[model samples]
Target: MKQKRDGGVAVTGTADKQPNAQLTSWFVRSGWSKGELARQVNRRARQLGAHHVSTDTSRVRRWLDGEQPREPIPRILSELFSERFGCVVPVEDLGLRSAQQPPSGGDIDLPWAGPQTVQLINEFSRSDLMLGRRGFLGASLALSAGPALLEPMQRWLVPTAAAPRPAAAQGPGAGGGRAARLSEQELQLLESTAAMFREWDSQCGGGLRRKAVVGQLHEVTDLLQEPHPEPVARRLYRVTADLAALAGWMSYDVGLQPIAQKYLVLALHAAKEAGDRPLGAFVLSSMSRQMIHLERPDDALELIHLAQYGSRDSAGAATQSMLYALEARAYANMGQVNKCHRAVRMAEDTFCDVRAGEEPAWIDFFTEAELHAENAHSYRDLAYVAGRSPTYASLAQPEMLQAVEGFRRDDVHQRAYALNLVGMGTVQLLMRDPAQAAHYTDQAMAVAKRVRSERVNTRIRKTTHAAVRDFGDVPEVIALAERLSEELPEVAEPA
Candidate 1:
C-alpha cells in the first residue's frame, strides 16, 4: 500500500516513498520568490475568510512532498502565483494529482480532497483560456473522458455532515481545532494553472479539449458540495459555477447540444448556491447561444430575455453585449429584421461601453473583430430571410474577408477563418456568382485540413455542396466540388 499524508497508510516495506521529482523541477524553474508567493496566498486566504495564520517556507516544503492544502488556501495560492507570474498555475503542479488520483479500481475515494480543489481551479482557468482562443473544441471532446470523471466527482460533492470546518475557526490563537493551511507550493500551482488556461483560451478553441475542462468542473462542484465554512463554500461555489458555464458554452460550440444542456443546468444550480446572479445570467446566455445554433429561435429569444432580466444590475459591459447579441441572433433567425437590427445596435452600444480592464473575467472572449464578425453573421442571416441579395452581399464580403484575415494570420485561429469562408461561399452563391463561390469554398476546404473541428468542416461541406448543386455543370465548380468531396466525404451524402 502507498503511504498517504494526513493519515497513516498501510505501507509495504521497501516501497519507494520519494516525492515527485518533476514537480520539484517545475517549481525551481518558475522563478517565483517563496516569500512573495506565501504573502499572496495568505492575503487571498484572508479575503476568502480563511482564518489568519502564519505560513512559511517549511509549510510550503510539505506541499512539495504531496500534502494537500486546506480550503481558501488553494484558491489563495492560485491567485498569488497568477498575480506574480502573469499566468495560470494549477495545483497539480504542486503534486496535488496524487491526492486526486483514483484508486486501482478507478474510484476517487476522497471527493473533496484539498488537492482536488486546487486541480479544479487550475482546470477552470485553463478552460477559460481555451474558449477565448478557438471557440469550444474542448467541449466537443468531452464525450471521450470528461463525463466519466465528472459524474463521479459530482456524486462525491453531495453534501456531507462530517466535512471539515472552515479554516478561520482553526486559526493560531483561537482554536480547539485548526483547519489545515495550504502550502505556498500549492498556491503557486493554482496561479500557474490560471495563467496557462488564460493563454490557451486566447490561443486555442475550448471545444477541442472540453473533456479536461468538464473534468475540472466536476471536481469544483464536488468541492462545493463538501462541508466547509459558509464564506469559504460561497467563494468556491462562485468559481466552480463560472467554470461550469464555460464548459456548457464549449459543449454547445462543438455541437454536443444535450451535454451542453446538462452542464448549463448544473452551472445554474451551482450559481444559485453561490448567490452569483450574474454568473447564472451568463450561463443562460450561453444556453441561448446553443439554442440559436439548434435553430430554436423562440427558445433562444426567451433565454436572451431571461439573461437580460437577471443581469440588469450587474453593471458589466461584456454581459450586456452578450445578452443583446443573443437577442439579435434570435430575432434574425425569426426573420424579425427590424428587431434584429435594433438588438444589434444595442449590442454595439454595449460593446462601446466596454472600457479596457473593466470587463469581467468570463466575457473576455469578445474582441472588436469578433463582435463585428458576429454582426456580419446576423446581417447575413437576416438577408437570407428577407431575400435581400444586395444587403447580404455587401456585409458578407468585407466581414468574411476581415474575419478570414484575422484567423488566417494566427495558426490557432485558422479554423475560424475557414468557417467564415464557408459563410462567404454561401453569400457568393446567393449573389449568383458560382465562380467566386467556388473559389472561397475551395479555400475553406483547404483550411479545414489543418483543423480538427467537425463543426467547421460540416458547415464548409454544406455550403460548398449547395454551391456545387447550383452550378454542377460548370467545369471549375465541378472540379472544386469534386476536390472538396474527396477531402470531406460527408459532403457526398444527401443533404
Candidate 2:
C-alpha cells in the first residue's frame, strides 16, 4: 500500500532524530504547547486551501526531533509562526532538512579575480539568459550563505590583479571573436541601454525584461573576451557591471536566487575591472539585500558592513546613505531596535547632506523617497518582530505613508509604488486600522496589475495572511484577504 497523499501532500517518513534547535527556538517563542501547535497547523491548513491535512502532537514532537514534514506542513508552520509573531518567519528559518538544501558544499563561491569574473558572467549570464523564470535554486544548488557568500568580498576589496589582459581568452559563452575595438559612442550606447533596463526593471518586474537584460550582459562578456584600449575597456566593463547588477537585482525581484548571486559577483568583478569601487560596493549591497530577503540578517549585515567600509573613500554621500539605509534594514530584521534607529538616523543625516550631482549616475535613485522607503521597511520589520510594541508600529505608519506618497508621485516607480502600498497596508493592519489597511491593499492590488514583480506579490501574500490571521473578524480585512487569496499564487521561497 502507498502512503496517503493528504490534499496533494505526499506523506513522507522521518529520516533523522536529532534535536532541531531552530525550530525549538521558534516554538519556545510561540508560547504554545505541542498539542496547541498541532491544532493551529491543522486550522491554518484549511485557510491555505488544504482543508483536509491533519497533524497531531506526535507530529509536532517529530518536527521537534528534526523530522521534515512534507509540503503544505512546512509552509503551514511557517505561516503560523509569521502570523503568531507578526513577521515573516521563512520556512528555511525552521532549520528543517529538506531536499532543497542539497549537500553542504553546493554553495556558489565564485572566484573574485577580475578576469575570472568576466568568464563567470559569460557562462552564468548565458545560462541565466536561457532561464525563463529559472525558479529559485533548483536541483544541485542551494542559496549560498555564511562564509561562502562573504568570502568573495575579500578578494573584491583587495584584488591582487583586478583586470589584466595580455592575451584575450573567453569562456564558451563568448562566441569566437577577434580582439575587439569599441568606440566611446558604442560605450555610451551600452550605458544608456543599461540605464533603460534599470528603468524597466523598476517600473515593471524582472520577469518581463530579464531575458533581454541578461542577453545584453552576455554580449558585453563577449566583448570582454578581447582587449580594447584601456579607456574603452574600462567603459565596457562599467557597462557590463551595470547590466550584471541590474540583471541580478531583477532576478531577485522575481524570486531567482542562486543565479542572482553569480550575476552579482560578476557585477562586482566588472565594477572592479572598471576601477569603480563605488560600483563594487553597490553590487555588494545588492547582495546584502538578497540576504535580507532570505531572512539571513547576519549575512546581510556582514555584506552591508563590507560594502560600507570598502567604498568609504570613493562613495559619495548619496551612496553612503543607501548603504546606511540597508544597514538599518539588516539590524531591523534582527529585531535590534536601538541599532536600527541609530542606523536609520545615520542614513537620514547622510541623505540630508548629499549635494546634487555629486554622486554617480547610478546613485540618482537614492533620493529622499528611496531612503525613506528603506527606513519604512526597517520600522515595519521592527514593528512586526517587536510583537505588539506599538512604538515601532507608530513609527512605521508615518514613514511608510511617506514612502507610498513619494512613489505615487513618480510614474516610473510603478513597482515601488505597488510595493509601498503593500507595506503601508501592512503597517495599517499593525496599527489596528483594518479599513485603512484594506484600502491600501486594494490600491496595491490595482497598481500591481500593471507591475510584474514577485517581490510585490510576496509582500501582498504576507500582508493578506497577516490580515486574515489577525483581523479575520473585520469585514474589510476578510474581503481583502479573500481577494488576495484568489488572485495571488502560493508564496514559495528558496526553502
Candidate 3:
C-alpha cells in the first residue's frame, strides 16, 4: 500500500507486517516478557562495554505497539536477537531501523578546509551549547568511529594551510567579511580570553564555565568568517582552534563522549588550517586519550603513532614528553610492562631536556606532577596484570603521594587531589589494609563532593565500589557504602 508519511509518499512492503506483529511473534517464540527482554538486552550491552544503552519494559512495550526505535538501539536489538536465536536477525528484519540518517556534513571528518572548518566550529558549538551534555550520549559509539576518526589520524603527517587571503573588496560571506581590518588588539583579546578559559577549567573544573566557553567559541567562529591578511588569518585560526579544543576537553571532563569527539575533530581541522603541526599533534593526542578511556587501546596506539610520525621533528621537548607519557599509558593498559617502562624512560629523558621558555604555553600543564600521576596510574594497571603483585602496589603509592603533594601545592586542581586519593585508597585496599584504604576512600569522597566534575565522581565511585566489594564486613567499608548511596543515588547499589 502507498501512503503519505512525513509529507513524503511511501510504499509499504507486502511482507511487512506491522512492527508490533513481528515483535510480538518474536516475544512469543522466545517466551520472555517485555521486561525480561529489556533486562537481558541491557545486561548484554553492559557486557559489551556499551554505555548509555537504556532499555526498559515500557520502551519495549512502545516498540511492540508499532513505534520504531531510534538509531543504534535498533542495531543493538538486532545483535541481541541474533545471539538469542542463533541466526542473523538484521535490523531491517526487526522493523526497527530509524528513518533519520547519521550526521554527515558539518566537517564531522577532518581535513576540513577554510570556510567548512569555520562552519563546523560554529555548528558544533551551537549544538553542544543547546544540547547540554546528556543528549550526545545516545550516538556516542557511532560518532566515535567512521571516516571522521580514521582519515584524520592517517593524514596528520601532511600539513595543510588555511584559505587564501580574500580581496578586501569582497563582501560578507563571499570569501571576505568585515574582518579585513582586524587589528593586533583584537587578536590579543582572543588569545587572552582563551587563556582565561583554560585557567578557569584548571581551577574549578569544566562544568562551571563550559557554557561560557561555547559562547566564546561562537564569537570566534563569527570572527573567522571575516576576511583578513594571511598572517592575521593564520593567527585567528590557531586561536579559534585552541578555544575549540578547550571546549572538547571540557566536554570530555563532563562525560559527554560524542560531543567531545565532534569538537576535537573540528579542532584538528582548524589546527591543520592554521599550519601548526604541533597544535594538530596535540589535538591528536587528545583524541588518543579519549580512545584509551573508551577501552580501545589499539585505536589509542594508532593515534599516538600518528602524533609521533607527524611531530617527530617539529614538537618541542615538552610536547614530546607528553606524547610519550600518553604512549606509556596505552602500553600499560595492554600489559606490555617492558614497553611501558621504555616509554616512561623516554618521557623522563625528554622532560629533563625541556628548556625554559622553549615550550609552548599549551604544554604548561604537563608538569612533573602530571608525569608522576601518569606513572602511578600505569604502575597500578601493571600491578593488576602481574597477578596484583605487592611490588607494583608499593611503587604506585609514592608516585601517588607525590602527585597529591603537587596538586595540593598548586591549589588549583582540587579534582586531581581527589583522584590521587582514590588511587591511594585502591593501593591500600590491594595491600590488604582495609582500614587505611577506607580512610583514603573517605577523604576522596569528601573532596569529590565539592567538585562539579563527572570524571572525579567516577574515580570516587570506582574506589567506593572496591571498598564495598572487598571490605564489606568492616565498619569503615559499611560507612563508605552509606556515603555512596547518599552522594550518588543514581549509581547502582554495590552487589
Instruction: Indicate which candidate wins on lDDT.
Output: 2
Model 2 Cα lDDT, one tens digit per residue, 185-272: 8888899998888888888888799889989988988987776656677888899999999988887787666567767877887888
Instruction: For candidate 3, write residues 13-87 as lDDT tens digits.
Output: 233545577767766787788887777666645544444566778768767767655545665566556535634
Judge candidate 1 at residue 116 and give its lDDT: 48
Per-residue lDDT of model 1, residues 340-359, tens digit only: 88988998898888888886
Number of clashing pairs per prediction, in order: 37, 0, 0
TM-score of model number 2: 0.78
- TM per model? 0.60, 0.78, 0.79
Misplaced by over 4 Å in model 2 are: 1-107, 131-137, 162-164, 167-178, 489-495
Candidate 3 has its poorest 10 consecutive residues by lDDT at: 4-13
TM-score of 1: 0.60
- Choose the strongest candidate by TM-score: 3
